[model samples]
Target: MRLYWTMPDELRIHYKNVLQKYNEEFTKGNLSVAWRHLERAHILGQPWPREHNYVHWLMLKFGIHIKDKKEIIGQIPRLLIGGIKVSLRRTAS
Candidate 1:
């Protein structure tokens, strides 16, 4: 988090745009393009919390409903501090 903030504001802004692009691609249901944005977001030093959105994408792509707690847990990395917090309305039912 500190490292990401240490970056020049201009560069940070560029990464923010990358994050937006990720959102844009995600909304379009283009997983490949969206995944690239996640990589770009990471390279720009965005923190792990940002990766949370990708997990949702994965859950949807794989047809893993949030109610299947264990399955959702297995899909994403556990290294990130916070665990899953699924919004039922947004996730697969």
Candidate 2:
């Protein structure tokens, strides 16, 4: 999905709000909520893999690097499995 960078002011505002909420959720240890907001941010931003800002920020947030097509694909299953394992451990304890 390609989102034009020339988004409306309202959409930009909404995006910023979502980002703030995402950060808040992360700080509060709400990984699921944070992930939801991050997903929304990714959709709204439509960041290209080569975009430095997006890639850097996402890497900082998720602790994963996507330096190439292969790296991006490799991260999918790892992220899912890690998320599931974390969720299960959270629930079990």
Candidate 3:
């Protein structure tokens, strides 16, 4: 929200853990597990614009890697506007 630099330490730790897990699972070809980690990261990052956008970007790349037309298409908008929406919502609140 407001592009603040202060992310709670716990959240930052959890977010990094999820991303690391996602990478590990992806490396092992555990696509489903990787997706789950990505999803969790997405939830964890919702309040931070850069993190949210980054997760969406990773999701988009994942979709492309898996050749999922729907996910790839779906993530485009989220990748483009998800962060802006979070900032706007926070400002409104």
Candidate 4:
């Protein structure tokens, strides 16, 4: 989606932090974490986040409008690789 507003450097920083947390929670398959981050981001004045952001949050929050096939299936193997990195660190410990 298109960003509708231009703000101060601080707001930009907040946006980046929110986006980062969103990615972190999304990759961990934690919808609650994702939603909270979005809420916080919105409170901080971020706008029109993104399709993936809203889609994943809605799927968890209300469990509605989740019907339809999408063209982008996401990178599962990438997630698997990230998981492997964590697993390897755990095994080492």
Candidate 5:
């Protein structure tokens, strides 16, 4: 199994805080707020493969929870390719 590790500490703190907000809002049934947090988490983690993929996975789950076909479909490609893109960007830089 390929193990994806955590992001650097600078980004990790903010990424984790955003995910924490996502969880809290999701638990409260505040879906829009939860999605907003997810987007923020995605932005914060965009440079790291593990964090990027993890956020997309969460997005996929959220889409399924809400039964949104568009989001579910969208997240699929993101989940699969986002980490690859991040890795490539890091390598090319």
Candidate 6:
């Protein structure tokens, strides 16, 4: 969900660590690992505002050839408002 203020320091650090891991995986051409890390980050529920920003940064960082970053980001609103659900879709077909 979309947090609108600063995240807790611990959660922020956790997210950054996840981002770093994701970037490392990307550099190694390990898309699967990157996806797994991103998914984990998403489930961590750190905070809304920072989490939204992180997701955007992640999309830019990892979704170069994928055209659904905006759609994926949009889901953040749903997540924030509705909580996690089984129907969440990160990529647009």
**TM-score for each predicted model, relative to the true structure:** 0.47, 0.51, 0.92, 0.44, 0.90, 0.56
Residues 1-93 of candidate 1: C-alpha lDDT, one tens digit per residue: 122214467776887798788778878888678877766765554233334455444544433522566745654553243323323222333
Put down candidate 5 lDDT per residue, 14-72, tens digits, no spaces. 88899999999999999999999999998988878888888999999999999999999
Error of 5 at 1 (Å): 25
Q: Estimate every model's Cα lDDT from 0 to 1.
A: 0.53, 0.55, 0.91, 0.49, 0.88, 0.61
lDDT of 1 at 86: 27
Model 1: residue 63 alpha-carbon error in angstroms: 11
Best by lDDT: 3
Candidate 4 regions exceeding 4 Å error are: 1-4, 46-93
Per-residue lDDT tens digits for candidate 2, residues 11-47, read 6687778788977987887877877887787666542
**Which parts of model 6 are misplaced by more than 4 Å?**
1-4, 66-93
Ranking by TM-score: 3, 5, 6, 2, 1, 4
What lDDT tens digits, residue by residue, belong to model 3 across residues 1-93?
Answer: 344535688899999999999999999999999999999999999888888899999999999999999999999999788888988876766
| Candidate 4: 10-residue stretch with minimal lDDT | 64-73
User: Candidate 3: misplaced stretches above 4 Å?
Assistant: 1-5
Q: Among all windows of ten consecutive residues in candidate 5, which has the lowest summed lDDT?
A: 1-10
Select the stronger candidate by lDDT from 4 and 6.
6
Instruction: State which candidate, 2 or 3, has the greater lDDT.
Output: 3
lDDT of 1: 0.53
Candidate 2: count of backbone clashes, pairs at least 3 residues apart or interchain: 0
**Model 4 lDDT per residue over 1-93, tens place:** 233324467676977788688669867878678767756765554233232344334333323322233412332332335334434444455
| RMSD of each candidate relative to the true structure | 10.5, 13.3, 1.7, 14.4, 3.6, 8.5
